[model samples]
Target: MKRFLLLACLSGLLSLGCAAQPAATNVPEAIRVEVTGKKNGRPLLLVPGYVAPGEVWREIAAELGRRYQCHVVTLAGTGGMAPLTVAPGASYYATYARALAAYVQQHHLQKPVLVAHQTGGMMALRAATDFPELFGGLILLEALPAPFAVHNPRLTPDSLKLPAREQLLSRLVSMAQGTFLQQQQMFISTWATDTLQQRRLLGWAAQADRTTWANIVYESMTTDLRPALPRLQVPVLLLGIWVAGKAVKPDLTHAQVQPLFERQLAGAGAGGEVRLHDTAREFIMLDDPRWTLTNIEQYLAAHPSKR
Candidate 1:
């Protein structure tokens, strides 16, 4: 059960990396996109992880909006947004990847920078891999190409298991709503330091569609992006948190985390840079706004949209 429990650790935790082509396909209403800031600024997309609402990026987007046109997204089924089930033979991650591609095309974004967190980062990675030309740059927060690699670097994509997601799904299906929320809040508290921020994340969890969340988590955990790292066409900046509230492995330190991230970067060729923070939790923006904002600003400066 080590694999099961460890994989679920971040279920409590926490997406991107787009190109702009033309073609207007209506993005389903389930995935809400809220665009604002700089009438003529560079297109910037911020995607949140797990069951988080678009609100998670509010502060960061507000600041980034000063120079970039910010398009904040609230994915289907979470954040009080409508939930949707993928049709047979389709997965949420793949579907969203296609939708995001359409979004960039429909909106006419020219190689927008994709900034995603956690699950959202995983989804964006899928899109980047499937459509490498969709983005000019990617900035990922508390995201890893594959969680298993952090625990066991020897675990290659070929060795990864796409476990039956039913065990975890059944647990959520049977748990009482109140109890479910309470347990989720506890896990979230460990990952997000601020009580108010914890409450906000829990608020989204409470309203989230459990089935959809489990499905996304299952698809995400089962995915292995390490193999695709070398194929990523855009420059990537990964901002990860090693300290703050890491409950899975209480003794987890920056040293252990840094090497793993560096290992992933080693596979990414010259287009990757990783910066791991020790003081901030998984919810870096909420726990350490200044640090989060500063790193993003620098990444954008280095990978300007003009490219």
Candidate 2:
């Protein structure tokens, strides 16, 4: 799938001489934005999932770079970006969302299409909700409306609060202060499925600030975006991957999964579209890049934004 997607993207590209090549760009340090691709092409912002670096979009960016200006963002507390220190009582994700909007405005990107994954998708959704005029479209890769909403339908912030807060916080604090190996072990065991990917994610997580990481997770868990969905005006494409074999309900069928995602996203605005991909979990990009990229291309084509 990886090779196919790479070739497919490369084959579709017009000759480089046909269009002006992209130039490197320098962005402010408040939010980590790695700019690439044709300066004249339509802008596309890539946001990675939690604990993931902008590197997660490396292959996708390489392909999309041929046709669009790609802005790969690494939010504070994730990957190599340093934790964002905010005033007391401020939410980290909320602060990051505002900073991201500022980055878009500062760059003068006119209605850039936003492609985000997992937690990053949530952040982008919140930003778009708060600043509806800033974005042209949204593509959410395997994004959940609420974390663990699939496992428990009745889940809410009040019901989902983390138990043993002090103990968990202490553990995260120790992991932050501990050797790289300790932190890496915690990261890998919890998230990564591939060995090399595990190591790469670990390297970044080790550099992340513990308080920032813990706070974001807590915030993400408590955040419920269902209410804000109907308020959005931009087009949204949700690509969901359903692997029944890996599911807790191994016998789960698409019939069941589709409606669950729909229910979770029922409050989404009229512009929202939900698609289900039959593939494995954890590494959506690596496992089926072709399907992922093809859907993304279709979504972009449907949206048809111009810089």
Candidate 3:
């Protein structure tokens, strides 16, 4: 989820904002990749959310790395990687999606299992849709094919072009470093229950390229993949969080959530399933590592690659 419901709220609390077209610039961007574990193990590509470093998957990747070769990706424009200068009217989403496809091809991953969260999930979905055969399976962590439209069928990418989110990013980006960090701390506090993890989140947010981050948020909110879902060829698994804990009146039930997930999966010719965690928040892996890993393991086992 963009900013953990700040950008993609199934609750419809935060309306996504639009951005002004970016000017052209000359810069070559590279995604930072960290490969580890058994050289012969099945490739597990891990992608983190907006402003997060690939290390965001450190804890879970470590666990999975014991059995799989994990290629953790920190996309260009964040985590110390130089930001990609998006041309006017161009899409950051497209840039990232293409980058992902190229990475898989360049690395010869042999139908890797892809695990992506939030904006990264959006990117992976686009890439998977465009190059389905490159991946063994798709696992989206708290991501929707059309995040903003999940709660509202009426919303279009054009409709979410509001000012609040974009303005907020502007304000945050303009703030002094100390103040910006404080704002980040406040922004992400609700995303994770762990204070330590919260600090790590803050650290990444601080290191992020403010300009690229703004473009990413705008692009993510404005893009919807539902129409392209029909092109999906690989098996998919959506792991969504219902709430941090307890059943609140507003929090949706499986009966309610399942249908939406099914709708998202309906377009996938290969089909898929959803696993909602009632007790975890946006950072489900950090909140419940065991649950996240176990679910992923099960999915991988059930959908072994057919190379």
Candidate 4:
């Protein structure tokens, strides 16, 4: 009876998972779910990072879709999509996880592989952990089970000091509430490029809801998923950037970050592997789409799923 009720609840949410597209050429450039690729191929879902649109997966999706059906998801409050309606003090990540899982069910996807970036990666991990049978595999790019834990595995959610978490949340909120120029500047510094086109793209990210962004960022930093990692039944692939050529302060070298990657893979049960790229930054898809596509194909081959 309990399982029946849960399925019923999920069925309702699936109805609102995505908006219908018109036959005419009036489809929204930015949407929740944009399907493309081979019509008779395996299903794969691409989830973009926080404050990023599904368009970020354009190049890779186009390539990967040639052999696989790609379902690109643009999270709400970013990329001109409507924000999820919620009351005060709601967990946006929880809402996103449900919406993503529903999207898979709604599309009748049979064990789709989930490829996610940053915060999307974290949400995908949560979804996979909760509903392991729904997915074939998972590929997380530069995601963290918990920021504090990645930096130091000795720290758990309970061991994390509240004052430090509060300060981090406060800073993230301030960044989210900053002006377009301020936000653009922040993006430029992190990405280390300020071309005219890049600035224009940053405009979309600048419009994200401050409250929603802050909530998810706070959750990703504070919520430790190490305990739930062992629950994952599907194959997991984690990719991290070395940033060897980039000029930055207190640069995170591969040697330093490799340990964190090892810890994550260790906690992710038996079906997981980690790969650290030499030159990619946060945006691995954009930095090296070929490498990303190749690795994904290899991983999918290793863990074949039936539809």
- Identify the leading candidate in terms of lDDT: 3
lDDT-based ranking: 3, 1, 4, 2
Per-residue lDDT tens digits of candidate 2, residues 233-307?
677888876662342456777676777777777776756777887654444675567788898899888778844
lDDT by residue (tens digit), candidate 1, 1-307: 0122233334443300234342333477546899988988988888888778789999998888888899998888877677776664357776776777788877788988888888888777777776777777788887777765666767764575444566656666677887777666556544577888878877877788887777776665666778778878777888887764345577777787777787766676337888977776677778877888899889888877665
- Flag regions of model 1 displaced more than 4 Å: 1-26, 156-163, 244-251
Q: Against the true structure, candidate 2 has what lDDT?
A: 0.67
Please provide, for model 4 over 1-307, each residue's C-alpha lDDT reduced to its tens digit, 9 standing for 90 to 100: 0111112112222123122221221123223898999997899989987777888899999998889999999988787777666445555565677677777766688889999988888888877876776888899877766655665778776775443434543554554334424534543534423364356456655666655665665566567777788878786898867563244435556777677677766877546788988866566777778899889999989888765
The residue pairs that clash in candidate 1, if any, are: 10-13, 15-116, 15-117, 15-120, 15-121, 16-116, 18-134, 18-135, 19-134, 19-135
TM-score, predicted candidate 2 vs. hidden true structure: 0.81
Residue 274 displacement in candidate 1 (angstroms): 1.1
Q: Relative to the true structure, how large is the alpha-carbon lDDT of every model?
A: 0.72, 0.67, 0.74, 0.68
Per-residue lDDT of model 3, residues 163-273, tens digit only: 555564565457687765655555464577788888887778878887777666666667778888877778789998765423234555656766766676667767878
If both were scored by lDDT, which would come out higher, candidate 2 or candidate 4? 4
Clashes of 3: 1
Clashing pairs in 3: 1-118
Candidate No. with top TM-score: 1
- Residue 147 CA error for candidate 3 (Å)? 0.9
Runs in model 4 with CA error above 4 Å?
Answer: 1-31, 161-180, 187-189, 192-197, 244-252
Count of backbone clashes, every candidate in sequence: 10, 0, 1, 0
**Model 4 TM-score, 2 decimals:** 0.80
Better of 1 and 3 by lDDT: 3
What is the clash tally of candidate 4? Answer: 0
